[model samples]
Target: MSTQQSNRVTAVYRTTTLLAYQGNPLIEALPPLNSFIEDLSALRGSLKCTPEEIHLNGVERAHSICRVIDDFFQPLSQHIQLHERISLMIRGGYVGRNPDTGDWARHIQNGYERVLSGDLKAIKFTEVNSTAQSMTLIGCSGNGKTTAMKQLLSLYPQVIYHPNMNLEQVVYLKIDCSHDGSLKEICQNFFRAMDRALETSNYEKQYSMRKRLSIETLLAAMAQVANAHALGVLIIDEIQHLSRSRSGGSEKMLNFFVTLVNTIGLPVILVGTPRARKIFEADMRSARRGSGLGALFWDPMDEGREWKALTDKLWSLQWLQKRDEVLSGEIRALWYDLSQGVLDIVVKLFVLCQLRAIATKVERITPKLMKQVYEDELRPVHPMLAALRSDDPEEIIKFSDLKLSDTDKRLLELQQRVALSTQQTPEEFAYQQLRTDEERRVYMALKDDFNSKLLAPIIRQIFDQNPSLTWIRLLPLVHEYLNNPELSKPKDNPKKPKSTGRKASVKQTEWHTLDSDDLRFIYSQTDSNSEIYPAISKSGLVLNIQSLLEEAS
Candidate 1:
């Protein structure tokens, strides 16, 4: 069948036999391509397992590949100009489904009988009511309300098939809610929002004159800019900032939102903290008429089997490969506990671990290494977590308003590691559990004398004596050295140049290695100045590699 003919048949089936067509196609036009597309989406949806669960099943590569294919399709190439084609959905309209969530979970601004919201299933308004409806995304931080809103901004199944775009489409504008709080600041933000949309649309030069203007009249001129780019959704993130302490900020901003949407007939997306509900409630009348508010609250994920599942998904990311070797289960679980299933924390934890693994030339990710990361890299995370755990809502509010200092940020990461690691037994605790001659000696030094430094050297001496022992065999030695701070301590993450003209100090740790390659790569980085340490063969090795690493970092 011709593409046009097939679409007509499918559209008729979709409208008349919606159920029969749903979950299944209106028409299975072909077998091979059709089934490949079908099965791929099924895997994606069921595979909605968290990073941890996916890691346990070893499926990160599959997920990434699917994402890449979806992103590059028509939605991307024609993003800036899709609004011009806006018209009524005629015969044979294509309704795409989310591969990850399948038909039931497919994204739709106008919820329908078959489509529903996750956990927030309140209403399913018709498509006719949705032509360009304004939406309000409400929720608390970390509850995933904001993240879901951002994710929903994109198309379901990632790609929209055979998208037809006119020369004039949408310009998406985002105004950060937590930014400078004032009526003037709001206008400035609108200007910046326009510039950002221009940048995204690759229409920078054409809008340069508007970008340079700082005149007061420029505020009212934002409408022209929106019309120029065919503005789409104007997302205002962190809307609760208005209530944070700006005089009449809410009223003025709400009025501006009203002007932008009601005056121009454009859709706006409002994202804010749970506290934002107070603002919306105060002006519920205006908000209702302005944009139907949909609250999305974000909080730390619930603790449950999903925790394990999320942890497993992260374990198998391609970056976890040791010398390009796949990551093992023991290492994966260690990473999970240290990261506590937080996406941001998990990614950083892994990156820190990977950089260390590369520098050390460790052949694999091990629980002990993750502990080293906790001490060296993640130690900084403690203070932020302290703030989060603080009982004072006022302090949380204050702290949330402030950016983290270098030391405080690092401490917060440490706290996250501690929280996540609660899922796994610490090395010290496990060692204490096992009683042997070596364990007893290390324990007594730490508990009785607190001679950790003295004990570490002794443990190091043992490893030096039997250097050929495998990591499994060297477990006793590792236990002793880990306890002995003097001989074996946590390694520091590489840092910037110091002004004092001090020589770079690379702290060496007597670590447990399960294999020979692991030990060799580690020792290779160290200097052989009677001290086994990583050596810099700067002249022979690639210096440009460090530049690339710096750029990427």
Candidate 2:
């Protein structure tokens, strides 16, 4: 939570229905628990758009469609259940440590005394069995674990300031686990999260910025701040990033989480990819701690009622010119095949396909268009989708975090550029065609003055003629062809047989049946419907233009 988030929530104090949650200002400050219907109403991330909006200019419609990324959450049953569980966790954690009863003050004093004595494990306060419990959510990447949690946490005011008690009750604090997974770093992050949640620098400045502090001292200090503020529930995301080598092995980190729940009375929620499951399974005690509230393992959705329900809701938010009032079964089936029921991919694929529809003037999503968008625009997640498609356990296990590779990231950006540009250049459409950085570098250099339509083929001509030529040597030959277009004309070569009359006269659309070297054949093979520039460069085809230009330059 930042200052901006805190401003959105008014500190309206309210009474509670449950006995355990009553009288504690920490629990009382929270909104009352509502019926399932109310929870569903509060959790939806719906977007608003009209059929008339599709008549706007391409760029405007594209900008409107992009809103789906931030504002198109449809609350599923799992989301509502998660919300209810977290609600219980927060209120349950506060039950044993009501501030008015001095139980909370005693916990804070005990933590300080432990720090002062330099013995974090010492028992300085009267033991009151904690109602605090910990839970874990393990799932595949992009299954909406983090997004769902953020939306659920938003239902509570993060920081509630009680002027009379002069305390800032942090309703919840969420932090990312460091890549190193060091518990000391986690404690430092705790202080940093507290600073952001309360808009104060005291804890972070005093504890986190200190250089000579021992890990035990940091833990004691961190526990004190959490107790002092009555911090409700602590969510640690990316728990899969925890490295055993750096964090003194998985057992130490698990023990620390256990201590937070069992001793410090702070409920903990660990969210991570499936890789984190092995960390918790290191020992039974750790596994028990992880399942205090029953751990949730979210597999990718199957093509069932839940999938159809979500897709139907998402289908209604289209900004396409030729909007289909109902989703056709063929397109729906194709969508599932492409996305494989991963929530993030499902939404993003829809968004990208609509952008493609508007950009190409197709103005409607077809099974063919959706498939092309997935193939051309979504190369980054090919491996992940392949693993899911295989249904093989070993292949799926290899991907803990199915993040995009660097090259595929560039491809996605190119797609967005092509989709949004009203005056889209040939290079924007052709760039995705160039497979290698070397090919793209040459195309980009000459694309400013020469048409990519003309430049890409000539570059391919040079590369095909001189396969061993470096981009350095390739640049000059491309420059010569840009100046003299006729130099690229086909000429007889001793290496090739003459084309048959039938082969030479093949119709353009049916030219894919011709030799692989034919430009018409290459153009017929592309996944994108935009232009033939990409396909021309993709096949190493060119006329005698490179040979004549090479000699002239």
Tens-digit per-residue lDDT, 322-350, candidate 1: 33344455465665555544444555565
Worst 10 residues of 1 by lDDT: 1-10
Off by over 4 Å in 1: 1-132, 138-167, 175-178, 181-220, 227-230, 238-248, 273-291, 318-340, 379-381, 387-511, 516-553
Which one is best on TM-score? 2
lDDT on C-alpha atoms for all candidate structures: 0.41, 0.76
Q: How far is candidate 2 from the true structure (C-alpha RMSD, Å)?
A: 14.6
Error of 1 at 345 (Å): 1.5
* TM-score result, candidate 2: 0.74
Provide TM-scores for the models: 0.45, 0.74
Question: TM-score of the candidate numbered 1?
Answer: 0.45
